[model samples]
Target: MILGHTIKDYKRENLLHDVITGIIIMAVSIPISMGYSQIAGLPAVYGLYGSVFPIILFALFSTSPQFIFGVDAAPAALVGSALLGMNIQSGSKEALAVVPVITFFVALWLLAFYLMHAGKLVNYISAPVMGGFITGICSTIILMQVPKLMGGTAGTGELLELLEHIEKTAEQINLPSLILGILSLVVLLAAKKIMPKFPMAVVMMAAGAVLTQVLPMKEWGIKTLDAVAPGLPKWSFPNLMLIPMDEVVTISLSVAVVIMAETLLAENNFAQKNGYRINDNQELLAFAVGNLVAALTGCCPINGSVSRTAMGEQYQGKTQLMSIVAGLSMILLLLFGTGFIGYLPVPVLTAIVISALLGATEFELAVKLWKVSRTECFIFWGAFIGVLLLGTINGVLIGIILSFAEMVIRSSKPASCFLGIQPGHKHFRDLAESRQIHEIEGVLIYRFSSNLFFANAGVLQQDIEQELERRGNIKAVILDASGIGSMDITAADRIEILYKSLKEQGIRFYITEHIADLNEQMRKLGIGYLIEEGCVRRTIYIALKDMGIKRPYPLEGGVDNEERSASRKRVDNRMQEFVWAFGSDTEDQIERQIAQQIKQLKQNGDVEKLLHGSWSHMEAFDEDEWLEHLEEHLKEIVNISGKDERTLAARFEEHRREIHERIMKEHPELAQRFKERRHRLDEHLKERRPEVYDLVVSLRELEKRKDME
Candidate 1:
């Protein structure tokens, strides 16, 4: 972890506190590690040994400040699965010898992962999947031990088979073991509930010991673990010749993936909780060392333990000293306190494991998931089932795959809608749903609602091309990029191609305000400089103003009537085309609807009919009347959207004013004719309010220019 070497606030008093915290963590970890060893099908003493030197080494060299590195349930279960798979008898010398080799393999795998920088790969595992998987693992771990907790020996197999066996033989459950299991489970649960800072596992173990001595369960047919041999760890080297190369490599690969994931998770989580920043590479190295120690010291593969780290946090342990203390405590237990450990009941260990797994399920995360999406909740549950039924690896993989599939589906069908200005407001919105706005002529503005990435680059290019093709007269195309934040190389190349295509066609290509990083990248590609500098508008308002397009003012004289008339006509034309092309679910129905509106308008008095008519019902109308009403009541539509006509008018003027001024200046001799035309334009705008005219005119102008070329 990024626990900086700079000691900004170290104190002697805090050091003492760390020591006290370490001792408590050590005391708690000792019993747990010993118990975990039993879970691994190893002698309890090896668990105790595994917790010692490895913990000390990791504490000193590990990145996380407060992470308590030691033997964990995941690695233990993995080891047991490997041993069983290899047909190695649990207590055989060969089984014992294979562990070191496995540990060495796990360590190397971790080192490789670190070198490859695969830490961020976990981000692809969606939150829902993780929640489901962890919860499932917790439930599975609990269920798997139910038989043992009740004092019965059952061989592992498929989850369903094991569960079926337990259910079929419920009556065979030993009453003494059941009572012990229930008692230990209850104590551990209660300790966590009432005093979480206290070592609940240790307390439960002590309770188990007390119950064992006071009412010896063995006499009553309750099973107990045999006495474990206690000693300092002896170095063990793998006998390469004794093991087949294929078996060793296969087992190593499997164990490595499991251990690497487990340790990296623990190290990162611990560092995050303790305000330390973890270096993924450094963490892998530390785990590599930890694994090496576990191998040579006659123990199963070790990984980061979330439970032990939580214990450290609860007890205010925030230094490697905690790990040292915990390690030393285990050594002392081995050297002189071995007899005391024998008194601990097997049920108590099972209780501790179950309870810890329950805590690790991340209940709070599920609550948060509910707020994100119901689909995510479904994913979570699916992964949870996968973990429970299929095991951790398979379950996690399923979740990841499902999440990725969801992303691809969404991106493949990203949202695209016509950009319409609020009826009287400056802000643009989706034309289909909003009553307030109209699509502008000579300007095709669109916003793509997802990242421009390799997966969706083709879609983006097609969508843009289709929009431009539909409005072939567009003078400027502004891409509203607020929704987009990232782009892949393919997407960048596609954008460059579109830019050059637009430029060749004399249609200015512009990107509006976008993410800074994307803007820089586009600039680096020289698209920024190649395009018209003024055309690269930062916002919708700026783009419209720069283009000199303006909305007509009612009963106002300052505005140029002809220009407003032309603009209104263009807007009407686009609306008609949009409605014709992609607006309605059915073309025949839309045509019928339009016909009905025209018939109704002819039959009713203007104010009376419109005042009472529902907008959706009145959608069908003659183009002339529809355009006139749209322009006249544009303010009303905009007002409903909480904006006014002036804002929209100002934006429109920003785009069209320059061209208007230039035209007037260029033809001084026709000033009088222009003035008369402006009045005629005003009269026409109020009466016609044509939707398709402006779009048609813009397209005609482009066609005329192309003919000149």
Candidate 2:
């Protein structure tokens, strides 16, 4: 559980990618580890030493598949500051003696954290906070490296120190170093588009080394890394004599906590981005082993290196094998390729590091938040700015606080709408977004779009009250409880108060369109009276019907904001029940069926057969109504088919006998129903539509004469 999870499904195709990624990581690690090493008050080579063993140990033990582990900024800076606080000189012999002991104690604290399951703390940090924290870290480190690209040493500390360092470096202006770094950055950045899988970071690094060898290094005064002494990292016990036990324990615990917090958050952030799972407890175990290796190698306390890990991910590293290969590659460099490190230009290396960090920054996340939710955007920037001004831990804290505040604000003022019944839709919709939707006469339907909790109960009540005031003659108020999944005591009590108030005003109050489970929830919350009093119904339609309100539920002043055409409204008026069922789509539905029926008529020369067989009219409860709907489209049907009205009438008369025969053959009940209740709608059709009425009457009379013969 603590290791080799990625290897269980190790992909063979990814071997070369991981190997090349390992080489690239080792190359990038040279400058970063050295920079952090100096910050931790150790010699540059110790950073390299720390990289080899700790990474290998992490690969063996870490549940994280691709997260690169080694010396990182937070723990290194903590160690360096601890040395300063204790009045010990940095990079001195006494400092060297004390640092490993500190690392050893840090490892012990991590072991304790593992036992306590402290890694679960990451579960509370939101995605926006994690993304912003990562972006801030990447930006800060990139700013630190910008000075090196302009011919100065890598800057330390926060945004202010980095800006100051860049300004100072700009003042001196090493022309050759600046040009080389910029060109290198251009190449690395350009490679991603031109050849994404080309391993350009390594190619640029090798080219930088070859440039230093071929070109004059001292003449141009280009900064390159110092030559590392060829030796393997020795397993040595820490000498604790240089610091008091109490001070060491205090400082080491602080270092360990920062390492654990910063690294675990970054690691889990990566895990989330890549769509994998991490066992938080086992991740702590990995941290313990990695730092123990750091202690044995006489290096600063180790943590997950976000900069290096981001670089590895950019190059498409897969599996823990990337970590093993990186460790092995570092070992090979220390033993045999140590002299080659002297020829690699700092400007070119810095450019590569800066470019990699640029890719890692979450600019897209910030922009998306800006577009969709302004409050979330504020939370993101809060974390990003906090990291630059303060540190990683404080940055995460600031974002979390902002997220909680936003949640509270949103819950207190959740979405609510006064709904109007659109003619064609079974469910009501928001009045603002609808056309030809009617608010029922003396009836108000309200919807609240979040769970009814203590914070948002007033919002629900307020929305209903405003609508009731606006329409003073309201007889019934319907709460569409579809959006209210459950309610708390405050909300339940608020509802009771609302019902009493509405009753006092002679308006009936009802709750409908919620799950049956919600009724049980209301009962448990002491609002069961709403249910017992027949105020809770299964649907808004039933609730209105029970209140003596019926179809086309007459609106306050006809259809409010009636956008339907006059001709279309006439069609709707003729088919009021159909419009009530199918809404605005009724005309289109009828026209399409008539179009389909004409095609069938052209082929079969049958009118009655087409009507009975049409799947579109299958939902009609009454055959008379279905025929009436068809008759409405019959004039267009005649014109589109190039048929005379008299000829179509003759066909209808002739098909009436075939309809009887077809019905007797297939279903006797349909024949009996047709005989019993035929021509029922024709009575109204004569008054409303004389042309259709006359045509239908002539057709039926012609059929009757033929039957008498």
Candidate 3:
């Protein structure tokens, strides 16, 4: 029952890797932590304090081994915004006193959430909403740092106010500070783009420290981190009397939600990448303890750092040992390195902070969502705008509300399409795609592409009724339940009403391709008897056959000789068009080449290996048309040999192996390149045709093993 039990099976080599990774992470965390602390309205050094004990606590108790908990921007920004709204000044005794109180209350809220089994609350907030909120936070953080970057005090308020403050302070900007800040920003951005693996923030900070020492920074009116206190942070408890209890509770609850959502996302992402799992409840407990410790130590609230976790993974960190190393390294910095850090220019740190925040903004995701689902795009923008105008807590609230609204609207208006048989295909397709599709003279096939729930049950009925009215001669209606994975009572009732109405009109109603559970639900709801006997069929083809409807052919096979002849004539016309479009000369060459290869296969008694090689060489011809012709020729061979379709299919598979082996032997270099190209194609296909891509990949892997043998 111990959390992060994977640590028990750790190897020495993994330990060594983790030790080095831990050290690297510590190097990165220190300056970033200080920057985040400034965002949290605390002295820059409090960032380091937050990173230390909270990280150790999280590492000890968290279920996720790879997740690096620290002073992340979102929570710190939220805390700072809330405090600023309450008129508390950043880096003041009042702000310092209030932060720990808020941190303590956040810890309590997390503990409450843990007890209530609220780990799944993160699921309620959709990806688009989270992306928009983070983007907004990034914008806010960047704007807040502009004044600091210009050698002025950090601004307070929302996006507009911050922008206004910057404009008002434009005349007071320090030239030297501005130049150094811009230079630091350039260095950080370039490092990120050109050498992502390098610790650009640390490098820039070091460079700034060296520059500050060599240059007369004080005389030039350039601000530097001159007051950094030496030695490690001492233990201190939250002074609850310093802030109103109601204000503390409200801010704590808001901060806790953001922390939980962000941390869980990071944990799940890393766990999935590493082929492991983390218990969500245990993660909550870990953060709760970590935050509690942060409160006790008078530090900012902590959350999982996605960037830091990625760094750990990049360095091959194996366990929580990396976090421990990071914490100890921060300790070393506090005890021995504060003197060097004190010489670091404030403008350089501001640039690091701005660059980091800007990087966190997800413009790409917003654009992608815009392309795929406009509603999700709206949700993202709404959340982002809310954060900018209304502040973090209210922005997130608005986003959550909008997300749920969008979900409801989508479910209430599901996509229902009338299906018709495509000209050269056996299965039914959406009627909208092709006007040439054949609709059965007295039948209608309808498909609803969503779960049949209470919200959309009436919509389903209306769509079916509309389709029935449009298809005037419909004697039978088949509901393609392949896409309807589940149904609620209201949907079931609506379906029953539709069936009764259709039956009254002398139209036969049938359901096909639904799971057994749906049928069971129907039976339990007293509508089972209506579909039990001949009313429900396993497939659309079976339903048509049972209704004595013969499939039209030349399209698929099995037809009367007269119909077959007409179909063949139509098929011949279509084939001529395809051949002409592809150039008849090229088609003829490909046909002759395949014929000659098959003939050679027959002579060598290896006919089973005929179609196994790369079809890329025959790219001059249309692949589908060529494959159809090849199949027909193969069928002729099967007829002459007295073999069945199943036997032919099995032989073709063997032939595929033979071709693969021959390619590896005679053209090994090309075969390797083909394999690599196929891998890239497989990755591309995953988004377009996941099932087909998976099957193809498995088959290719099997062929690869055969080639190896």
Candidate 4:
């Protein structure tokens, strides 16, 4: 689908640039593919064969527009080891014949994986594990090339065996070859730093060819690639009768998995960087076709090459057209330019392979892993060490096992915190971080910061019990379930037990902010009926209100203490008039009249003055009946005054002076009584309920500002 889409949106303007980029990638791919063919235990010519048809096939079918599939070191080394274990000699006719059979099976496995839609299996390999695996492969590749770098035969086996072989052959090292390899390494590194955009690998290979032809280095014990077969690859089926089907299938499965993981990682990284999307299943199918084509042409298995993909990206590869051009260029080289490749020194190719592998090592990622998570750092080291001591496939397996164990450990001991209401805000924050925040008087707000599952059920219970013990006076508990994305049956059962236990202790238990999916989970698990009626709320505020507890505020408002007292006295005089006029027989009627007058005053746009005049009247009533009625009337006034507090406060202050003057002139005799009553009320508020006094003052100021607006 992506190939069809790319062709549909093809642009004539990008053709020249794409063609140039293709040629550049072609030049860079030639020598590297040759060296990797040796790594795959095949002749250098087969490497050229692997690159040509494989590149064309993948480019033609791939969903990722920029990715270039070709011979890569990891899968090559894996196939080489599998063949070597079977006692197949490297670079021999028998080994060459067997490679295509192995590759064809690998292709079949990839096709099977595509059919299964198994692309998401890559998610199981965490970043640290993948980094460690690549780092280990880089070390293995560099060590394997050490013998070639020193002008001797390449050694095999584990890292220590290879090191010992190099040491045993130290006396036979050729000086000219060593010098040429060192020079090549220097040139490659310098070019990378100074002119990274240029085709450094091609330039170095060409220079190596010229030097070998002009100098007497061959006489001094330097080896050259010699003559490469000059022709296009022939299509032929593998002699499957000669190979063990079961052994080939096992090796093919392993190689297929490694290729899938590495290729998907490279494809996803480049696609994200360039702002494109790739279908994973389509990528798997493309790899299947590429490897099948390579097998038909008698070449090793192929996968996406990170180095070549990055080179194509750096050179501004625009589309699959670049890949097509690259495939054709390889064909051109096979037709006429094979003679030039024959003169290139072996040491130079070794240097190119070593340099590319070195670049693939993620030392910075290792450092970051150490800094962020020590357990993940251990996983990286486990894989890295396993590869060095064992082999590539075994090392990755060890890393995967360790990563799963670490994940289980983390989930079993999830981080949790007690929440306290932050000052001046409704949010319940972790009290450990905000020490100034006060805990609610009889309520506990607890937050569990992980998914609820079997491994953590007991731990969750322990944590809740410990918190309840630490805070002895908590009568209502609100479990903030916002962090819990899902829950298992074990966790739901544990919660049900906790609910029953808290209910027996006379403490109300509630859950807040749980998602709909989690609610459905609880119901299916039979824990929903265990929770008390009205115990589930959408937010902390709603939960607190259901428990009959009001939120706390700081003892600060726009009105000063003296101004608030003056306003209270004016309201007290009005309440005294109502009390005297109604007497004891009509107390209920008097309360209704007062409420109606307050409502009327609010509608007449005099809310600020009315609220100021009513403040002391509300306080003068008895606490149970009269205060409840007054609070109901005040709530109505708050709704009428609008929800914005600042505007209300501003309007209240503007009308304050006028209300005080009018009250003083109309009731001079009652003024002294009002002042005394206000003094007593202020003392009572300051001594017993400072927060309530501040809240009442704030509400009046807010009402006043609304009236003025």
Candidate 5:
């Protein structure tokens, strides 16, 4: 009972600490949220609304307890533009009323995605593409705000057209506003560089507010917040029936998807860095509910703000305490701090926005992107131009569409190659690199280094056709399936078409070494049995041999094992005791047995006879020098007797495999080479076996045929 009480007290104490941390995060969030609201062209009160009930609601249901969900710059700018289209301004009741409605619809869209578990869909927007889009957006924001910061009448138009007008009126720019703007930019940039932890936005806002008290900003025609309404949270709603429901519905859906995607990404990223988990579905619901609240009052589209979340994390905030505390802090500010904010200058707000934009911009990635992928860089620039000319929503749409188009383009041209192993090298390399290996006649081994999917299906077909065209005598085409990772229905259809087309051309098609996943996919599509499964050489060799194609390397001179007399053949004397089975006690024990056998063979002069007579049996001829070295060091095969050279060679290979397996099984820490040698020897023994027919003679015939051409 005492222990239980102590545990309960500990939990309570931790909860209190979490609550305290939440309060500090909220304290920091309020000022930033207000500043961001100005960026959205909304009243300062809207910022409070953003950090209040919506935050609390998100805290209740959001996956990330630490993620401070509130009004952010991106959504605010988007909402402000949307309101302008509806002939509404920031402080107007009409714009304020619609803010929550837009937010609600956006939340609904996010909820749909979460329910569908569309987290993986975020992969479509590659990092390079996002980097470009962010840079473009930042550039646009800076340019758009420059005229306002200079206190100049930059005629309202599209972003690019407005920029052109601003350029023309540079001489008429107000000196005081320009100075203020420049100072703000410098301070914001400096703050980020020198004291990243300090709230530069707030500091700049304070400076601008103080400057307004002494300077006659209105005399200079400088704009300011001017007025603020102080009150507790209130209920409100946008007139959905009166507004253009169709436009609202469509635009709201698009905005919602973007907000959800960005928010979920931000939440997941922060959660991972901080060692927590994010539930996409719960976040969707939370934001959806919050947006409903925003729409009821006078708030614009709101999403999880990355800046505020970062602040919360920096302050070591955990759980919903931070968001709740931040909300309460906002309530206190609303009751006391409304009048002071009205003195804040537009130039300072511009500085804050600019700083936020600069922070959001991925300058490093922008530089790397140019060198990394020109195609993706092009899409980002293209989208930037589109958005600067058309609008934000259109620009993002074009960027996404272009991204999809790029995928199609890459799939249209897959990489194809002919492969072979270099002479005296075990690695299978491209035939282009290892030109010394003679091409087996009437056979071509092609490897498709991509998935057999719809995008590259036609490309695969064209490559196959090209191979056939190049080699008219090609009777067999073996697909090296080692690289093919996947296949789709369209790819399957194309393969079926190719199979029939080749069959008509008197050529047999085969697939070799396909991975299990692809093999299963083929089986599921009912075409597994159509293609033979094995190594490219084995499959092609067997197929050609069956089709009357001559073997490249047939057994030449000794009596065939199949035809040899039983008396002439060495006895399997230890067959009853299963002599092939080596002891599992240790690697040293099995190695000692093999060494003894090799020594006996050497002392008996069997090694000397083989060295003098057979090139293949010589010590230098052995591909694995370790085996030959061990043979020289050993005394005799005492346990198993009378093993001929053929049997001994086979046993030696087996011994190597056994020793490798023992090292891997028992001495796992020895070296990486133990695993490599084990695998190599296993593959060699499994793949390289003597064929009954001569293949060299067939190659000679094929060479003559090619020479005739």
Candidate 6:
């Protein structure tokens, strides 16, 4: 037991607060425990019986500071469903006889779980599957309880049976019971919103008990609970030989798995929030011990209670002593205060159970998944509908299968992107993220952001082939293997095939920026020639050096466009980058700025004094870089303003004259850069479209001829 270790730092002054918190938890648990007991196919009092010894035992063994174990809804509903499948009646002699055996098996399964250290398996059950499975169980239980409000017994089993029960019970509608039930639900839901921390269920149960005694509710068709027989329950072993071993095993394993997944998730969350760690395997042992005691005491299965734990935490309950006090408090209630339970109205209790289950349902998670991924939302709905139409076990199986299938699909086509240089940063980045980033002139750098396995090998081949086809004259292809942690036979075979295919097409293939383990894996997979032939490199810089490509590596490629010379490719890339950022609508976006800069130039009679960034139309750290981009877009700006080519040529001449005078007089160092920018744009346009280039040039020639005349 971890009890001594848990209370090692126990303060003498903390006793009173733990006692008070325990009392409040007992107050809240009375109606809830009774409701879940009914759900477990036992009479209302067994819920209290389940709460006491089991909780005290769990507190003794648990590492958690504030997790509560009791007869909770999920396991109770599962047991109740088991009863229906076996044709056992609810709250009857046969059900009471068979249920303890189920609890015995649940404990046995939990022991096996602890022994095998199977708690780690909970990590594999995704959130949508757990949320949907639990919500489905709660919804099923809600439908079971709905008949109580209409003056009928709580119906059990799947959706069709419950719907049929409601239809059959429609003839037995008691006006007083229905009205009381609706009013009780109103108060319960209202209290949940208004004072969520208060124990409103105890107050409502007290009111129902008083009303049943004072008014002739029995005469009015309002059912009341049978009075609980008090004092501690006698301890005895469950006669598991009564039920078939296979049936019991199936039901018990399902219940144990549900308890571990749902309860551990919630408990671990509380532990993390409170800055503590829980031992998963030890927690499994605690559950086994708690449930073993529950079975010996003739109670149904027990589980971690989120509601009770929240109340304990809210009341500032510290250490496992809080669970001890809560258990002891329930023991007192069983000894002295079982009288009022007989007068408690059935609909009122039904309302309390329904209210709690409603709160427990993960409706918000469904909404969130809907907005995030419809496929995941489908999984949520699949589990929910499977529970309602099929059963809990099948519902959970369907959810797990769907989750696994989705995971496989995601792995089959992982994220891959083309890498490019951003100039200021030495390393490359994804080109799709920014317009400023550019690819190398004759190299394709593709990054696959996951391990290369059979499922995604085909995706890698397809992405590379498509890029190569779009980029015509690629001399080399570089695979950025930084994201790849490992490779499989299928992926290695595919890589070898791709290397041979590209070699046939006269393109060299290289893999770079990967750990040495990758090369070792490649060698083991029979592709060691890549390492020997200098095709596998430790970094992109080394790969470029091997390819005779150097730094400021040509970020100008006609590969995605068409084959072109170096100068044409460079000028074309510059224009393409500019148009990508500030496109055809650049005239509208920076219209005022351009006009102001032009007016400032005409007013001052000097282009050097013009405001910067007015024509660049983007945030710029390099004035020369953006100015070169502007020279390419002068044709578009002139055409958009409805100016003739003659007028545009004259405007271009004025800017050229300003640049020459400014570069020669003040910035003599930049004379060569300014001279390079002078005709590079015209050269790109003339090569791309000869007629328009000739028309613009002829207008300049006519001006020169007139000056000669």
Candidate 6, 291: how far from true, in Å? 1.3
Predicted candidate 4 versus true structure: per-residue lDDT over 595-655, tens digit per residue: 7657676668566455434322222222122332333344455577664544443443344
**lDDT by residue (tens digit), candidate 5, 1-709:** 1223323454554465455555545544554566557656677667877778888777767767677788765677677777778777766766666666776677667667667877666556655455555555556656665676777532333576767867865867777777887888898788767876555555666677788899898898777764557887678555666556787778788678767766765566556556776656667777777777776666767777765665454434556666766777777767887777578777767666556656655567646667887787777676667656765556666777888888778766777787543333333356786446434456677778777788888887888798779767777777877768888988888888888798898887877645545655775676654622211122333334445543222221221212233233222111111111112222343344445545556567454332222111111112243453343322243223455534445445555445546545544454365545545644543343322012222433565797799
Alpha-carbon TM-score of each model against the true structure: 0.66, 0.70, 0.66, 0.72, 0.63, 0.70
Task: Score residue 637 of candidate 4 by CA lDDT.
Answer: 55
Candidate 4 positional error at 37, Å? 3.8
Against the true structure, candidate 4 has what lDDT? 0.73
Q: Give lDDT for model 1.
A: 0.63
Candidate 2 residue lDDT tens string, 501-600? 9899999988887766787787678886565466876667767766877555576676534344323321111222333333455456555656677788
In terms of TM-score, how similar is model 5 to the real structure? 0.63
Pairs clashing within candidate 2: 424-583
Summarize candidate 3's per-residue lDDT along 3-65 as a digit string, tens digits: 246456766787776777777677566556776788898998888888789998899998777
**For each candidate, how many residue pairs have backbone atoms clashing (under 3 Å)?**
34, 1, 3, 9, 21, 1
What tens-digit string does per-residue lDDT give for candidate 6 at 499-570?
999999999898887766777688789996676465776566657766777555777643232233433222
The stretch of ten residues in a row with the least summed lDDT in candidate 3 is 569-578
- Model 6, C-alpha of 273: deviation from truth (Å): 9.3
How far out, in Å, is residue 295 in model 1?
1.5
| Native-structure RMSD, model 2 | 16.7
Measured by TM-score, the strongest candidate is 4
What TM-score should be assigned to candidate 4?
0.72
Which candidate gets the maximum lDDT versus the true structure? 2
